[model samples]
Target: MSRPILFFVIFITLLSCDKKENSVTDVQVLFEKVDSIQINYLGSPTVHDLDPLSQRVVFMEHSLSDSGHEIFIADFDGNILSSFIKDGDTRDTYGHIMAPLAIDGENSFMAYSFNGFIHYDFDGNLISRVKIVDFFNPGGRILGMGYGMEKWEGKYFYVNRGSKNADYGDKDFFDEYHTMYLLDPSTGIRESIIPFPENSLFMKGNFFFSRAWEPVFHISESKLYIVFGLEPVIYIYENQAPFNLISSIPIELPDYHYFKGSEKYNNEDVRFFGHRVTSGKISNIKYVDNYFVLSYFPGFDAADTEMSISTNTGPDFWNAMRKKYTTRIAILDSQGKVLNDFVPEGLSETSMKVKNGELWMMGKPNGEVELDYFQLFKVGLTTKGP
Candidate 1:
């Protein structure tokens, strides 16, 4: 090869690599500021869930009216595109169908407990229904449903199922031992990726009912990331037992920071929330990233209650009773070092998804009870020092 040709080839290769690097870096800086807020409802509007299909966002709203809860589709800017009141009683149903609206190719599908699963075309036309029984064995139950059509190397579409249990707690309840399954919707075949464990602690506990399992599973052509939350148990004693009386013992788990637990479980920190108390138990786990984001409600009880009163306390005593306020957010890196902490305003539900160097979040404003609005926020990540 000529000397000039060699130099030209090296220059081209270097430029190509720089372009690829710049592309990734640019995505991290693509975070959009809060341009506006759109309210989907005015009076007592309840947003059951939200899902992203194509570039559109689909959500369900439950309100008080002649018609019951209905599914509504809109754009990311909160422009209502389409809606229809579900026939019959669609209210009081379990599972968050809006989150996992699976877009299989051009068609979208959502699963419900009352009616197995419903499919719709790209234009939101009703397609066929797939019964839960047809896919599972007799006496099998529907665990949970999510919608999104993701394709790997093959022609198969993947859907997830949350395992079901008759003894599972009722509405406004949570089960600690929830299992997840990955299914091939095209063939109606399913395989368990996370199986339900026997004698799950979250199943039998009564002090604090478990909440819905918000299992995060994001898949790309080459990688898959799953995020799940777990709580630790804090035991309580009936009387002044030695274990309960110990204070400031300097107990330390290798990686975790122990905090106070509830009085129900023997009033001991042995169990943090509901599971065995340990530093390793409370940390969030992200796949292959070498780092995880640990999130917890600091001042809230296991029941998610913001306030409580003592039976022995009078009106005046109520004022004297110790109250705890919940801490908002804590961002930790792979080594469990606190990196950032911020109290997000009106943030009820927080979900983070990172793609192409950008962090996308679906955050509900004004807590989950009084607000039915969601805000999508983005933040760019750069190598530059914060």
Candidate 2:
């Protein structure tokens, strides 16, 4: 074949290959329920999530106070490899570790605070800071909730909301929905917005929707999945500028459609209730090759309090609430079809992560205290014969 014709043929073939859909992946997935394997580490604030590297795993370690936080890098044997962001006071290099964004475990990682974000390597070496005060929002536009962002393929996707106490131009002080933007990593400018369905707001209130609601984003390959920490919905999109919402999955959480007003709480300042109707929501999600593994809590019924001596959910509220409810998990295929559903006892999705072909999470044997152990669940996939 001539050079021009050969190149043409190769181009055509590549285009067709890109058209191949995931439905053709004959890979069948199964949860083996292999007895839980516990990491040698234990205690309150145990390893929350696992970021599996070829040689180690990295998790964000937070102390009782902000100053002692560090990016804890450890081995499966529970030996510390290296810890990053040694001192939170190093404001020039590292900011307060408000929320752990993610770490590639090799080149770069991100940590978030109320101010903005700081980037570092696995060794805690500073790469740069994405400071909003002097860098991005130099205008000091109102102080809204800062962003939680992730860097994928050299681009950044910032997720957060506007302020609830201060307004900036068109944005309301009590905005109900979370806002996402495709940000320029070099300039820290919002290039474009990623729109969510207006109906997806858990509620239209102020702090209830803004403060209590947590959202998580998982990126696998070239796809991004948006999961509400307090709702059983998954929004999937192509991971790119102006992320195209390709599909959505509703996992049917308890009272997901139920809503109420805050007047019942005797707080007129609070807005209406939607997510408050249900005490639980989807806690975490992991996107494996051809499967979507997610975990959720069914929530505790207040009526259970009437059945027990628990007159008040005081200092032991978390323990009592955990004992009061159960955790559920679901497995879905690339087609958004349910493959299998199971609720494992003592499984928490609060910091669940899919790593090295396993579902990793924080769990307790029989917790009277706080989450005390990190465990792994085996996820099995078998390719059927054609």
Candidate number of the best TM-score = 2
How much does candidate 2 score in TM-score? 0.63
- For model 2 the local lDDT of residue 180 reads 58
TM-score, structure 1 vs. true: 0.52
Worst 10 residues of 1 by lDDT: 6-15
Identify the leading candidate in terms of lDDT: 2
Residue-wise lDDT of candidate 2 within 288-355, one digit each (tens)? 76677766665445454333334454557655655545565556776566554445444453445555
